[model samples]
Target: MEIAIGVVVGAILAIAGFILGRSSGRSVGLSEGPLAGSPETDDHAALEDRSSSRESELNTVLVEAIGRVSAFLKTNVRKPLIEAGEAAGADELRERIEHALGALSDIDFFLEEPSMSRSGQSLVSLVENVAQEFSGDQDVRLRMQLASSPVRAVVSGPVMMDVLYLILHNASRFGGDSTIDIAVQAIDGRSLILVRDHGPGFSDEALQRAFDPFYSTSAEGLGLGLPHARSLIEQMGGQIELRNVSDGGAEVEVSFPSS
Candidate 1:
């Protein structure tokens, strides 16, 4: 009987030892499993996050491009069509549409990335060319005095075009019988371009507030042209100022640092 009891006890101790060893082995395996897979899983998750961020950035750029295109179409193409439909002569309408499209194309070209400063010089040339084109027909003469020596500066092509367009348009529209003059010169180690129009001059107060965003004297203006020009000039580390001449005119002076 005693020998049998001792045998039973020994058997129970062996069984308990086996179960404890199995449990310890399972605990050790579980601890190492996550450690073995964690690095790869973390790497995959990081890649996914980066991909998502890139997609979002791409979408934002696409949306901006689409919006600009839509705006151009609406303003240059659609609005003109609607307005011209009610007018008497189709010739005037056609001319207006052509001019609008040309201006819009110029704006689009300038606003694209990889902006070339040469584009600004090209724009000045284009303005002179246009003036020469209509020089014989128009009563108000346009004159350009570009720098004999190249005046190179880092500037956004589109914004420069806009500035030129606004100044020229204003000059042509309001310059009664006087000729519009443009002079590009170097001043204080910077490039200074001045557009002078012999139109009704503005008050000193107006000159001070002229560059403020959304400020305009014209009832029909979008009140963005001058302000936008100023903003762009400032962005390129330049400055613009407006002044009234004693000879009944206004002058827009744009200054840019040499590249």
Candidate 2:
């Protein structure tokens, strides 16, 4: 039991370390950095490539092992513990366990390299649906500036909607009762989803660590929302940008290929 607990803890730490050490984004479609004629630079590049490869291999193994552990914990440990807690009226224990499980879910999403295949979906409809879903889930209002022409984006609609929903959810969570402004536009062969929140725009530190896992401006945040959102978007040939709107708000713009 000691060894089993140790392994589980180790695996969880491994996942945390992997994310905290994350640099250079995902391992796909990245351009080589700063090539020069110097032999020293070439040597450094070779070492970096090998290190990067090794890290990727470690991540794969860690996820497979941690996934099994997570499943077992959920079924054998988490459920029983939660039930016992409820029966004993150990509300604090149950809440702590539940919070850990929730953190694990976010970490799993943040760590995985998603392979999202795209199909042409109407960007406009997805936005509308996501807006509706958000409003239904919470007492938040979403205002839209949809394109005049129907824009078809080469992306999975469901995944995109989830990503959009997450963006809105974050806005609503932090932006208080202010209305969220979302704009869908097609520009330069790209489909853009712009989410702007009328909150205290990101601080300099927040902007700097915008997508870093486990970094959050809110005391209540576990902080993987934007990082996971970026991973999903990047996998599907999309990109997310963070900026402060000059007019006292935060803006997140996601772009994808327009079909």
Candidate 3:
């Protein structure tokens, strides 16, 4: 299954590159159908139109591929790996695999273009469910300050769960052995989820490019967590912010369109 996944992902990546090559006005010498002629032969307007369409298609491919692949790894690979750690070396290997699996989530977010549809899930309940996973299966201690009132957001429940997972995952991974703090608030027209971690906090450079793809402070990661989170949130008609708290640690606030 792993080998099959690799081959499939590799082929999709190659196709994405081919589409990218065409979109960027560099042909890979494919002499077939719409890809036969060089850009110079086409009128300026037609070239722009075709390139735009190809780019859109490429984004769709990326979003679909990453989502499906990530889901498969989570169920088939990550769960077993997490459950079978009997040695220090095995733990290290599991950590590395987690980082790779995490990259897929980030890439999926970066490629997602439009806002996700609301699945009519209660915001408070959805967050609590995700929090339970973190505290139980992941063994990450969490302190929750949930809202007294139930709120509904205009966002997809599954995607929002992924977003919350990435946020909490980053907090736990970087926050060392400290307990992460979480809060949900509904105020005015927005519903917010705030997560704080008692880590060393972001360096000056991290604060600047924390949302840039493939930018990671740790060597084990591809650094797509925050970038993907931010991109995915923004695309969902929500806003994500990162900052260092006054005393210590990092704080992330994600606000969604709420009723």
Put down candidate 1 lDDT per residue, 1-259, tens digits, no spaces: 2432343344334334433443343223222233446676675556556656655654554444344444554665566667775644878877877866664554443333334354234434544555664455456677788877667566766556556666666666555545889887776678887888887876666677766433456543434467666766777777888888887788888887765
Q: Write the per-residue lDDT of candidate 2 for residues 1-259, one digit (tens) a residue.
A: 4544654676578555765456444444335655577556776677678768877866775565456556655664556555554346567676666755664555454445555767899989999998888888788778899999978878887788879887898888877556999999999988898999898888899889868655676544546578778878887888999999887889999998889
lDDT of 3 by residue, 55-92 (tens): 67678856654555555556545565566556648667
Question: Candidate 3: which stretches are off by over 4 Å?
Answer: 1-115
What C-alpha lDDT do the candidate models reach, one value each?
Answer: 0.60, 0.74, 0.72
Give the Å shift of residue 220 in candidate 2.
2.2
lDDT value for model 3: 0.72
Q: Arrange candidates by TM-score, highest first: which order?
A: 2, 3, 1
Q: Return the lDDT, model 1, position 24.
A: 43
| After superposition, candidate 1 runs with Cα above 4 Å error | 1-140
Worst 10 residues of 2 by lDDT: 22-31
TM-score per model over all chains: 0.51, 0.64, 0.62
For this target, which candidate reaches the highest lDDT against the unseen true structure? Answer: 2
Instruction: Tell me the deviation in Å of residue 179 in model 1.
Output: 2.3
Q: What shift in Å separates residue 61 of candidate 2 from its native position after superposition?
A: 20
Provide the lowest-lDDT 10-residue window in model 1: 25-34
